[model samples]
Target: MTASPSKLAILTFAYVSLCVQFIFTVGFNHQVHHSNFRPSPTIRLRATTQVRYIQIRPGAQFKIALFADLHFGEAASTEWGPLQDENSIKVMNTVLDDETPDFVIYLGDVITANNIPIANASLYWDQAISPTRNRGIPWASVFGNHDDAPFQWPMEWFSPPGIPEVHCPATSSAHSGEEECSFKGTGRLELIRNEIKHNVLSFSGNGPRDLWPSVSNYVLQISSSHDPRSPVAYLYFLDSGGGTYPEVISSAQVEWFQKKSQEINPNSSVPEVIFWHIPSKAYKKVAPKFLIHKPCVGSINKESVAVQEAETGIMKLLVKRPSVKAIFVGHNHGLDWCCPYKKLWLCFARHTGYGGYGNWSRGARILEITGQPFTFRSWIRMEDGDVHSEVVFS
Candidate 1:
């Protein structure tokens, strides 16, 4: 049947509307930005200039500082209080000053989006890593569930045609929380890539270019300083994906991990470590109790548990890959345990950010990796500079 003029008009209007929306989205994407905050030190560091690969000669050891859940800019206006986020940064700096790690890896949830405006987010986020950048230390990171969550007080949309259709203020309508708002605000993917481009000291990998939608997956090869091609170890940074994304790593991501792990050039299964924001399913097996901070030969302190049930393939792959000896993660702010999950030790970095749910003393996990036998030792470096959760990888 032939459509009436009215029907034709409606269809035309709909098509035009969609086209206009796309244009607006493309145009506005450029406008959204984080505020003026210098993350780079006086001297801008480049990933290429800064040493990414670690070359562990015969008896030498590589020290790694793992800091997790530095949930900056959270609860800016809560009774939970002020300086919570600042305190986390302060703890990070103290650890850097004292230990002087060879490399630092932030295990996600780097920033809490709630109660924050999109523009001011950089101020708090930059502060979280200023210590490492200022020290010119090589650093990398993975994403957590909260990294992309909307700021606590996200910018509200104005009335009329200019009002944003997505990530609009939660109060745009009757929704009690920003969760109901279509607007997701800026996520960790963009924020992280920006740093990689701007800061040379940042070694955080941009996720798989062909297979991924966001920026939380990539391999940071720690090769011998003498020979860039000869890798000493490989660090895989995977996004556990939460908040706006699924809470688990996808099967595709697992396949990608396997592909990348296998493609370590001539070196297959060379010593490696996995850093993600969330723990794998195996973590729950031994993490039932919250143990005190004391590093034993086997495992160390145990905090509350938050396991990733969907990580079966990755865990299985670890068993097959002898090169991967340790898998470090953060999400359970109260937990800092490291136990074997088959072949590799499933470890947690001590929570360093005060913005998260835990009040447990802020701390970071310091790793000492030695070559030859390829064994390693680690301990929790607390905010007060005391050490705990010390253990030698079995």
Candidate 2:
């Protein structure tokens, strides 16, 4: 049909408009479908092969290696700083090689936040756990006072020229990933989050948000090797506050502990052990006056107990709970002892890192647990491969 020029033009315009609409519709739907399938950049998916468990064999003993106050990246700029970190790593490697522990516990102060002088302390934190991770050993950690403490500028660095400009090397153990360094210390939440995200062997957790300023308040159940469903013991890791806040365990944490314990172990049947960085006031009372003699066994007692800022019923609650077998902490480098406090024992790991102020030889506390008739035996494994201060938790 030979139509008029205007009619032909109108028809052509309509046809082109319809084609454009159709293309737009299909493209929009395709984009939406693919977007739905894509995962968020921040979200992580757990691989099926990543699943692991901690269980004690029926006839075998479950051993744990406790490395406290590794304090990696303490003085990154100084000549001796890196040397200290290397020594600390050697200490861990020595202990791990000798004990071949089933699990490892970094009982806080894994990195000295004040000394990190970097935005991401996890870099140093990662180095601290590298030995354990390399060995395919599972581990958990709790926050310590210096883990997220504010950075303190070295007074000596302040000269007449007004704050000498300090520069960090582009590459170092703490900067293994080549991340930009800063004085802003990494917080506890970020540290734990990064650990769990990157390391499949890490059992570390960022506990409830409501327990703000107090992260890492969680419990782990150790199941029997014979029966995976049957739990043998409970391990509680609490964030005794420090760094950004006062070094105290709040009443809320105590309440949380009570509720959580009741919910998990209503009958108080399972034997429980606790791990934290700071010691409580109860430690002061139980500490040996002169020498670490009978009833109390330890290699060193050169310093007084560095108790928490305040005691808000954690000790009281623990003392009343018969299921709590012992509490392990590490803060005071000069003191490493296990003293009885009423129903349970209070113990400390030997000063492990050379970064902190202590000339004491580096070592780690090793705990060996038996399942059938439950028993806990502990001793220190020194950097030089010496073992001493063996104690049985009764």
Candidate 3:
């Protein structure tokens, strides 16, 4: 039977709409069920990949590489041209060869999307950290808010018992009854845990559950393997969920942090470093004077306000703790460093995978920490090789 032109057009539109919905549904479902729930690819690459070396003063201080916000899938191209995975791999390989540090720490936002496909995130992590893992150097990572929610609960397909199951709103609308609504206990959390266990040096975070200790954050401490009594460095990996969307750190996390801080140093000698996805309140005070009160230029809404009140609270906590040295963060996606409070530096690293408005270059920071003082060196990848930014920190 032949249909009229009007009927045909209606059918076509309906078909297109259904197809679009189907794609979105599949993508979303894939993210919830599979994201962070599998083992990364086992690709065997050459061990000779070389990275540029930047010599630090004294030459004896321990080096710690800080890589944040890779945002792998955010790029337009599947294979990020020279600067991304390729350049990153080469640089990491070289760094591992040159500076055999005790271990490495990734500051979060390993995956690009808030709801990334499990395969994409897994593949990205596999490629990104394969070099480090292959070398046997332990690396640790914290969860960025983007690495959480709206995807799946208890993302624990790879590792069991690490994540606990929690009830979240069911994603499937068509399913009937409570059984259809609830997700399998050990799916999403396992994936993230396994990724961290296999790829990271150490792993700690509240998976699938409402951000543990805090709402969505955790703290990590690194010490000298040789001398436990010797003052080493500490990292407070705070989860500033997403952006300034008005969220508060849970009371439990705050209490935990306070207890941990007290235990770290009764006298407080060990230097501490805080890593958060979003810059804290102290960051704005310390933000380059030019960035402060400056309107969000270009397409970004000027009145949105960059810093949030919760940041201030976070800063207050840090300020109270004399051991904290600096707060490292991403999300703003620019090069800006500030020292608002006494003896505290708010450092922002450039994004490695994605670029900001009009800023297309890919870069990251390598931080070196000794007993009391620390240093940071920035690197950018150009056409020939990676270029070192002249700015050095002490």
In terms of TM-score, the best-performing candidate is: 2
Q: 216-298, model 3: which lDDT tens digit per residue?
A: 35444443434333335666666565422233444445555676677655566767777766665555554443443322111
The TM-score values for the models, in the order shown, are: 0.74, 0.82, 0.60
- What residue runs in model 2 are displaced by over 4 Å at the alpha carbon? 1-53, 159-161, 164-182
State the weakest 10-residue window (summed lDDT) of model 1: 10-19
Instruction: Pick the lDDT winner.
Output: 2
Quantify all predictions' global Cα lDDT against the true fold. 0.64, 0.76, 0.45
Better model by TM-score: candidate 1 vs candidate 3: 1
- Model 1 regions lying over 4 Å from their true place: 1-60, 78-82, 151-184, 265-269, 288-303
lDDT, model 2: 0.76
Clashing pairs in 2: none
Candidate 2, 1-394: lDDT as tens digits: 1222211110001110111111112101111122112111111122232212366644667788899988887877677887898899899888888877778899989988887655667778888887776655667899999998977656555446544344444465443221233344688888999988877567777777777669988887776767654557888889998999789888888898898888777888888899999999999999999888889999799998889999889988998999999999999999889988899999998888888888988899999888777888899999998999999998
Count backbone overlaps in model 2: 0
- Evaluation by TM-score, superior candidate among 2 and 3: 2
